[model samples]
Target: MNHKEINSFYTYLQSQQTSQRFLYQCYKKIDGIDAEAKSYENCTVFMYYLDHGIKFYNAGKKLDILMQPILFFYGMVHLLKACLLTKRPNYPESTSVLAHGVSARKRKKKDYTFLEDEVKVQHNGLFPYVSQHLFFIHKMPFEKIMMKNLLGLIPDLSHLFHFNNQESMINVSKIGSHTIDFTSRVLDNYHLTERAFLERIKPYLPPIVEVKSNHTMFQIVLTKPILEPSGPFFVDDNQNIFFPTIRENFLVVSEVMVHYLLLYNLSMLSRYEAEWWGDLLITKPDVDYPFIAEFLRISAKKMPLLIGKELLKMK
Candidate 1:
């Protein structure tokens, strides 16, 4: 769905009655606990988060690019908190879950580039907490990801990488409801044989029906549509699936997590690294400008869709 539809979807949750019902069902399904009282208590707070998040995104749209990251990052965080409340009735059980849970370098080298910079995941706080509770990702303490790698994880931004003579993904063509097709040379790209490549992707996909191949293309039939693909497989804004051409390691990150990490760094830079942030925006310096600018634009529209989809599943 587009941003407009997703915005409306979030608006539905703004009602106390609707929000409480959703939380009730979600808590029952996810935790199998006493949900009635908890849902009633959390519904107001949930609506507040959705309200603040939508406002932050709205404010970001009217602000200058320099301030957009800060707004969007917190916007995503507040929305995520709402998501967390669905599963964990008593959120912020302690202060540890309140932190951002990720850190970028405090000092920049004279020649530092944003793409080359990194963020390290901390053991506690909202980042890891949501990673575990919302997305079921765990054991991510102290893991370091380069900014460029995180940017490459976004399917909507794949074209930006392609414009710079890089291939972030290989698009998969859908032949029918059950099958998908892609170039045979994808095997060469990953240095995997057809059998080996199939084995590698098996864990990420649904049950396979069969595989067929020709000199130029390979087709794999699946048991169901890839409605919620993951890792190496991603469904883009247009509903097309792609296998990331980036390293397998980078492909494992979900788009939501990728956006969060990138926005966290960008927000930090906007807040603290004032000199470099201003210079980059005003000077139109390097390729970093294009990637960062494109991401901000895309995330402004894309984040709501991502978060909205997650909320829909909870219902």
Candidate 2:
């Protein structure tokens, strides 16, 4: 298997690398960009990237040309997301102003007791949203780096607790999207028992959650509700995806297993999500998105077992 450079291949790579760095710098330059956008009365940098992304897709049939749309998308979405999560305000304000917005509806002050818990040296991290994605990449053999990069977009687990073999798991984390994507394809294509298959996988699930909220110092816990739902369908409320055609609407079904993976690892994963969203040090005084809190409210019990019912039906 041999391939040639798509002309400005190195240049394109440099652009992507540059995009990665500047996108990260959006936090620093956001106020200036915002001032310009506001003076010109235009959308913010985040929306600008998203709009360009859509335009590139709708332009025409994209030539392989270094996987332009996919790579462009990879860089844009992650960077834009980082900026949006950092939501710089129009005027001056303390950074924590946004932090308080996204925190969950705490039943009591005790709910945040984990904040006072002791810190420990930790290493390994969790690979999330793997179940649905793993199946698509491996079993279905979708060999695009789009899937690989999307899966790697948000790697690692809660800073509160980590595993030991992060060195090896990090490799798996990069390959996780492919692996999880492959797994879903296998489940549907091979007509495996969804219940029995997941049940069999229960024993292999890792335990890494350290709930320091209660009197317990550092007891390990696993967020495992997604593994076993009360009915054939698992209900999720926040999922609002639009695909006009039946053939093009596979994302809804495909993401069902992703929801499962998220549910199973909600504990540590929630913390990770919050920390990233709340990362204000990178930005000068900005508000953070409460992505973790919104994620917590997703009704898994109500979400349809998308892959089990829809994808399996297609098979």
Q: Which candidate is the best by lDDT?
A: 1
TM per model? 0.93, 0.20
* Number of the top-ranking candidate, with TM-score as the measure: 1
lDDT of 2 by residue, 1-315 (tens): 001222122123234343343334333445455443342222344334443533443331243322232333233232223223233323213333222111122232322322222221111111111221223322322211221111111222111112321110111111111121122333343355544544543353343233222232122234542232211111222221111111111222233333322332333323344543234223323211222222222312222122213212221
lDDT of 2 at 105: 25
lDDT of each: 0.84, 0.27
Q: Show where candidate 2 strays beyond 4 Å.
A: 1-43, 59-315
TM-score of 2: 0.20
- In TM-score terms, candidate 1 sits at 0.93
Provide the lowest-lDDT 10-residue window in model 1.
245-254
Each prediction's RMSD over C-alphas, in Å, is 2.0, 21.0
